[model samples]
Target: MATFDEINVDISVVLGSSEMPVHQLLRMGRGAVIDLDVREDEDVSIYANNTLVAKGQVVLLGERVGISITEVLMRSPEIRPMRTDGPL
Candidate 1:
C-alpha cells in the first residue's frame, strides 16, 4: 500500500468570482478592475482536487502573498449537510 503522504493533489485557493458579458470582457484593458463577489474581509475557499477542503484568509508576508489556514474541514455527513439558508 502506498503512503498517503506520497500522494499529490491539486490545491487551489479561490478568492472571488465575477460574471460579465462578452462585450464587457472584450472592452477590458490594462489597469482595469473587475469587481469580485468576495468581500475584503471574507475568508477564501480552499479546494483540494476540486473539493472544498478548508477556508483561509489572505495575508502578506514581507513582499509575497500567502494564505493562512484558519480552519481545517472534514468530509463527514454532518459537515456535508445541505445549507438551510436557501438556494445557493
Candidate 2:
C-alpha cells in the first residue's frame, strides 16, 4: 500500500466571484476592494486539487483566520464511470 503522507494537494476556498471590465480592473490599485456575490452567512466552497470537496464557513481565531467545515461533498460512484465509448 502507498502512504498518503507523501502526497500533496492544493486547497482553495472560494467565497464568491465577480466580473468587471478590463478598464475597471486595470484602474484598481492597492487597498482596492472588489465586492463578491456572496452574503456574510453563506457557506464558502472548498476545493482540493482544484476539485470541489467540501463547503465551510470562515472563522477567526484570535488574530488569525480559519475555516470551519460545515459539510463534505462526496462523489457518486454511479455518476462516474470509465468511458469506453469513442470520443465525441
Candidate 3:
C-alpha cells in the first residue's frame, strides 16, 4: 500500500457537465462555468487508483474547496451464498 506522502494525487472534481475542449477552454474567462460529470445533491465519490474508497459532500475551504467525508466505502470481499439443497 502507498502512503499519503508517497502518492502524487491526481485529484478530480465532478460537479457538472461540459463538452468543450482546450480551444474553447482558452476562451473561458472569469465567471465562466464549466460543467462536470456529476450532479447536485449527489454524493461525490473519492477514488484511489481508479477505485472508489469514500464518498463525501462538497465543502468550502476559504479560497479552495474540499470534500467533507460523509461515508467510507470499502472494497468488500466476494461472498458465495450458502447452499440449502442436499444431494439427491
lDDT of each: 0.93, 0.93, 0.73
Q: Which tens-of-lDDT digit does each residue in 1-88 have in candidate 1? A: 4687899999999999999999999999999999999798999999998999999999999999999999988898875768899996
Please give the distance, in angstroms, between residue 75's alpha carbon in candidate 2 and its true position after superposition: 0.8
Candidate 3 lDDT for residue 80: 30
Give per-residue lDDT, candidate 1, residue 61: 100
List residue ranges in candidate 2 displaced over 4 A: 78-88
lDDT of 3 by residue, 5-86 (tens): 6868665644545687789999999998777777777888777556667788888899998888888876646643356897
lDDT of 2 by residue, 1-88 (tens): 3777889999999999999999999999999999999999999999988889999999999999899999999988885556899784
TM-score of every candidate: 0.75, 0.84, 0.51
Candidate 1 vs candidate 3, TM-score winner: 1
Superposing all C-alpha atoms, what RMSD in Å does each candidate have to the true structure?
8.5, 5.1, 9.1
Clashes of 3: 4
Best-to-worst lDDT order: 2, 1, 3
Task: Name model 1 segments beyond 4 Å from true.
Answer: 1-6, 77-88
Q: Which stretches of candidate 3 lie over 4 Å from their true place?
A: 1-13, 16-39, 79-88
